[model samples]
Target: MVEEKSDRKKTNTIIFDASKKEPFNINEGYKILHRRLKNSWKVGANRDAIRQEILRTCDVFVLAGPRMKLQDSEIEALKEFVSGGGRLLVMLGDGGEKRFQTNVNTVLEEYGIMVNSDAVVRNVYHKYFHPKEAFINNGVLNRALLECAGKRVDSAQDKRNSQGLSLVYPYGATLNVSKSSVALLGTGTACFPLQRPICALNQRQNSGRIVVLGSCHMLSDLYIDKEENNKIQDIIFQLLTREDIKLNQIDAQDPDITDYTTVPDIGYLADRPFGCLEESEELPSDYMKLFELNLFKLDNVTLPAVLESYEELEIKHEPLGLIRPHFESPFPPLTPAVFPPQFRALKDPGLELFDLDEEFSSQMERLAQLTNKCTDEDLEYFILEAGEILGVFQNSSVKRQATAVLDHIFTQVCEFKKLNQD
Candidate 1:
């Protein structure tokens, strides 16, 4: 059953599994790709174990490089979620269990897809990084949908299309789709000079759909925007924004959790060891029972105070002549009151600053592109420049606003650092 959240309108909700020990998560490189999709749908992580109630709330479910096997109940929940017209995107890598130990094949077998245990390598047209960086030169997007996208199918448009477009498959496994499945992208005689299926889509029941990709890193933050990997983004866009799928809010409670709480205590131990096993002695069961009985008695009994007369204690306050020193803050001082017009006024400089605006726009565009693949040092350098730009502005309020934006980006860097630590 679907229900709307009181805070916002109901849209498609794509839940990425975090409970299954996935290598990729929102905290990592997938942050920006998800940020780009914020306008169309609600994308978030599922921290709790998968259950029927949780699946009912999600429009699309993703299991990417899961390192742990799903419980029996979770498997049933997933099966029911798909049978009830939900969409599932399963991503597996070439090394499979050897790398992540996530045996997703058990779930894929039920859907008529098999994840090969071997990695797909291309010695001929591989990326400079490694030979395993395979690229698909003849990927077929839903051919009919390509025409439906627009009238003029230019090179840029063709790259977005699923039909006859070469896409970067990267380090992934080759797939084995069933007879009813449609091959989205083929190996194209690149990996071992033998064609194989890399991505497959299957239609189950009336509205159910399942897309299996052999590569988990294809849509990751690092590779999603690389070479031909943008095609994967196009595929994701089509999947989440499709008009045929009906989206609903999940409102079911997790059955695994309960109200009752169990508190463990050292009192439950029969004996305590000091030096070695021979030196340790076991407590008498009767004495332990008596001790527990006393514990309960103390909960209900409050002993009287030793003093007969109750008196309030007073604390003496001593004023120490503490020296206060004036220290300069790192941030610039605010001068909004001195120049109120610059801070509060909204005036369009218009074409007067067109040349400057064009230059600023180009710089911003370049910064955005660099943000996707830039190193930590590059981000720090740009942030320093951004701070300098803010300092150049005469208006204190404008500088404050720009600082906020820079701070937000800095938080993203901090999150990246924390993820790396984990």
Candidate 2:
């Protein structure tokens, strides 16, 4: 059977991927990934925010891009929300798109941050998210790079490996931050130039608490595995579940009232990690506010999930662990045979552009299989057509009118077939 995502209700991780469409079928596309990255409590009750709920329920949020670029209303809402104390979880995508980053960075710059998209930047100092078997500790990660690397490294690089600096663009960009801002991790091998830094931080002098992370792979469907073992996950855990900042640390003396907003009836919200506090007065009604909520595990051990009959998905002894299909039981034509053969040709060093990596080809082969509905042998030819298109473009050295056009076409086609299955 051709692989396709199902729209089933499951605990929320309602994603906002810059690369995919709205309301992704997280139950299947990202369910396993979520479980791996999540704390014990979020597993059972699908209490996650899909779209609106994501903004509403989260204390601090994480986002992957090539999908959700910033806009004016979104910026205004995010700023007010964070200034009111909204925690943000952010990452950078391919720094190869100027037009997309231009508008996105506009929203971010007002926050004291900026995004740069250009040239493929790569360097030895930069660490990739390799598989478990490939995990390694290469060097002492200057905490600055760690922000982009992750709180948890699947493998630690040897600290002795040291002393290197390089610049490469078109890879992933950096958040050129304002003076009030500081890098949580140290500088690394390559970073895209962000023309405006303080802008992404909402022009705030203290947006460090805002938590800006670079590197978008952390949450992608293909990259979530990296997050499973990322050192960044620890940072996320600390940021999200703990709602208290020591009350005694700030200057509480009778001063600086103009710059600060006050929460009137603050009482004991919790005692362990510190205390959760809120303005005893009514808060704004905006779904995009920055109010924080320290989530406790979904202690109600049961949750709902849909499953293909051949596979039995048992949960943590919870009755809610069953999936309801859109129309039928045992997803029809359940055979792996229909899936496409993900073939990878050995690289020909003779041709740089012709060197299609196994990863790229694997993705295209599967995407093409699904997009053709795995039924149209004629349209199925586009798989080869697309690869040839890349080959031809590289050979002729012609600039494109638009980037990602072919990607858009292919992805839309795949999505069409995925949703159209009846």
Candidate 3:
């Protein structure tokens, strides 16, 4: 059911929009980022006809859409474009209330990728990634795929699915990667996985480079900063052009997606809050100092001791002005505030304390590590606390606190599941 676009010759600009659904601010979003009525159309991709227009004519198919059951022809067109060397950028979401999972990943599976229908990737509150209500995380783009994307907001909030993840704010989910030319930028002892933004980042045997993410709204003018959304924009540019990196256009859609029989439970990652860390220049130097303090009890100087100092660093500025100054706030009321010392206190008391800053910073780092590498013993204690905290968050106005509770739940639950099954 593909809609036949007016075969417009001006295909060079770009085609951006959602599946013509109610919630997606796709068109307006393009206006904000590109700052003009984009040659982009605000059509829907979830249906057959619209999918045809997008999958066929659009040079780079940019999407931040609700769940869509792909039509066969549209799927074929997508494969053909990629096989013939066209680029695509799709941003799947937790979806609107009409929420039914689509198998976009099944088609990509032939190319060594898979996007599950029910499983939605959620982000935890933190630095480096989520800054505003909408924010961009990170990715390893195939140089050939991301060459065109100059800059675009990478992640945003879901008015419907406000289920915040705890691993990477506005970003969450599991990613098991093999080896590829995919180059990820960022450093830390442990690496976080791409939950929603997972597809576009993977490479398929068909030779097309895919740059996936946990959420699509990550790219919004509401969230864009000169330095932050590069991962999304870079890949956007890469999908529009070729020869920058090695890629193949796929002709046939992955057959598995078409089956529509296998979708199961929705929640794929652990049930608890996924703890995370994100960095942005707009916020206070120690904006994340509290999370660090609340989790591990170490100071910044000591915890990030191995990392470079924020003082020596300079963040890239946006031509349009700092992206809505999210770390600050769009709604005057949402501005982030320093917490009362006790309110920000660590949930557990086992860790040793050092200097004020170092104590908190060290604790945050350790807690991050603990979440990443939780054990049977840790799970027992965390489970007890998670139940209590979940109740607290149930009546709370704060989301970060909710995220902290979930982080512990998932980590502990993971251990609990493994142990019980064993």
The TM-score of predicted model 1 comes to 0.51
lDDT, candidate 1, 258-366, per-residue tens: 1222234477554663565566577777775536565455442333442222333343334657799999899997767674355667786665534555366665565
For residues 251-355, what per-residue lDDT tens digits would candidate 2 score against the true structure?
112111121122333454333346667769676789556544546434443333333322475434446656866865766775666867878888756745544
lDDT of each: 0.64, 0.40, 0.43
Model 2 accuracy (lDDT, Cα)? 0.40
- Best of the two (1, 3) by lDDT: 1
List per-candidate RMSD values in Å.
30.6, 37.7, 35.6
Q: What is the clash tally of candidate 1? A: 4
Candidate topping TM-score? 1
Error of 1 at 221 (Å): 1.5
Q: On residues 123-232, what C-alpha lDDT tens digit does candidate 3 reach at each position? A: 44434443323222333222223223332222352121112111222322222222342322211112322222233344444344455443454456544443445344
Query: Model 1 clash pairs?
Result: 57-250, 140-162, 141-162, 141-163
Worst 10 residues of 2 by lDDT: 248-257
